[model samples]
Target: MIYEMTIQFRVSDISKGQHWYETLLNKKPDFIPHDGFAEWELLPGCWLQIAEGIPSIGSGPLRLGIDNLEIERDRLINDLKIEPFDIYSREEVPVKWATFSDPWGNKVGLFEYHNQSEKEDRKKTIVGKQQ
Candidate 1:
């Protein structure tokens, strides 16, 4: 028996979906099937796939994990043009994670280590959100 972990996103438009995902993943897809789909091999088994449809608001019992969240957060903001739907953080937590909504409403997360400077920055944001 064999198992394939493919996460499918129903996109509103395949072209826009492809561009949005390309920006996030930093490359074009490894494959395109027919006129309605693309395959982005994000990890060894996990794939980011988009096909023609209305797109899901979100249906998550799923997430892509990383060793550190803050580093990626910085890159996403500075290098990859990520604007988050929501940002979350805490001073004491060693992980700094954020969420981004793709063009067709798929969710993407970026993360980095909560080093002292990052912790201070996030602490302010978290504290500000509380007020």
Candidate 2:
């Protein structure tokens, strides 16, 4: 059966990539096994690896769930100097989201659930797993 998972993003400079990700995630990496790589355990079993290499063209908008998308969007803009981007949602969709690129062109985004109960349930699930 399938188990834990990892997702990787490439960058031209490992140190810069690590710093950028640290700022975006608001924490240091969980692992730095070697000189050119870093990894963050985003959730209990989900890992995001950033390595030194050519960034993948049109690779991903690796979206992360947030409690407040507008707050995060503002933080990214003020702290990271990310250009402003539009947030979008649909009539039936339960979450609103926005996408922005990192300095190295890695597509990243934030999302927030419309239903407060659903968001609370997700937080409890993740916190329980981490403990």
Deviating ranges (above 4 Å) for candidate 2: 129-131
Q: Candidate 2's error at 59, in angstroms?
A: 1.2
Each prediction's whole-model lDDT (CA): 0.68, 0.89
Q: Whole-model lDDT for model 2 versus the true structure?
A: 0.89
What does candidate 2's lDDT look like per residue over 1-131, in tens digits? 76688889999999888988999999999999999999999987989999999998656879999989999999889888889999999979999999989888889989999999888888887766324
lDDT of 1: 0.68
lDDT of 1 by residue, 18-118 (tens): 88678667799998978989998775566778888887786442354444565556666775565734447788866666677665667766555546666
Please report, as a residue range, the 10-residue window in candidate 2 with the lowest summed lDDT: 122-131
TM-score of 2: 0.93
**TM-score of each model, in listed order:** 0.64, 0.93
Clashes of 2: 0
